[model samples]
Target: MPRVPKIIPISDLRQDASGVIKRVSASREPLFITQRGRAAAVMVSMKEYEQTQHELEILRLLARGERDIEASVGFNLEAVLADADALLAEQQ
Candidate 1:
């Protein structure tokens, strides 16, 4: 079962932004901010945000690879792997 995200009113966020931010970081879950009883914005911890961005970047790379394949663009698998390994090593 999926856990429901924490929801708060904009006023509550305005009143205690730090507290709300702490809750998000501790739970590692998104906090949904509502305005006038409607959904407004969402917030997540820096850790979660970074992880999401990394995953998104991987998805973008996969999409680009697919595009390249459809366009008949040639690429060497070994060279790509070597470049990927170098990039991963740099991250480490």
Candidate 2:
């Protein structure tokens, strides 16, 4: 079963901003903020945000590699692997 998302009104958030931040951080899930019954923003823990950014960066790198291949741009596999290893190590 899919989990229902946590949603809250802007007014509620404004009333207890600190509590809302703590809830979102502890839950490690996106907290949907609504204004006037419409989606206004999403809040997430800093750790979650950082992880997402890292994953997106990896995807972007892979996509760029694919584009380079399609364009017939050549790279040394060993050198690329070494660079990738260094990048992954840095993340750890």
Candidate 3:
């Protein structure tokens, strides 16, 4: 079974901002902030946010690669692998 997400009303967040930050960071999970029973904003730790951005960037690159392939653009496999390794090394 899937786990339920952590959620709290805006008021609760307002009352304990630091506590919320700690929980999100510790769990590496997004915190759903609600306003008047509707979802308002999501909060995440800096680490989580950075990791998410990196993953999205990889997805974007893959999508761009597909577009290039359809356009008949060419790239060397070794060059692509080397670039990917360098990019990943920078994140470490």
TM per prediction? 0.79, 0.81, 0.79
- Sorted on lDDT, best first, the list reads 2, 3, 1
lDDT of 1 by residue, 1-92 (tens): 98877899999999998998898999999989999999999999999999999999999999998999999996889999999999999999
**Each prediction's RMSD to truth:** 5.6, 6.3, 6.9
Model 3 alpha-carbon drift over 4 Å, by segment: 76-92
Candidate 2: C-alpha RMSD to true structure equals 6.3
Candidate lDDT (C-alpha), each: 0.94, 0.96, 0.95
Worst-scoring 10-residue span by lDDT in model 2? 68-77
Specify the highest-lDDT model's number.
2
- Per-residue C-alpha lDDT of model 2 across residues 1-92, encoded as one tens digit per residue: 99999999999999999999999999999999999999999999999999999999999999998999999998889999999999999999
Q: How far is 47's C-alpha from truth in model 1 (Å)? A: 1.0
Clashes of each: 0, 0, 0
**Model 1 alpha-carbon drift over 4 Å, by segment:** 78-92
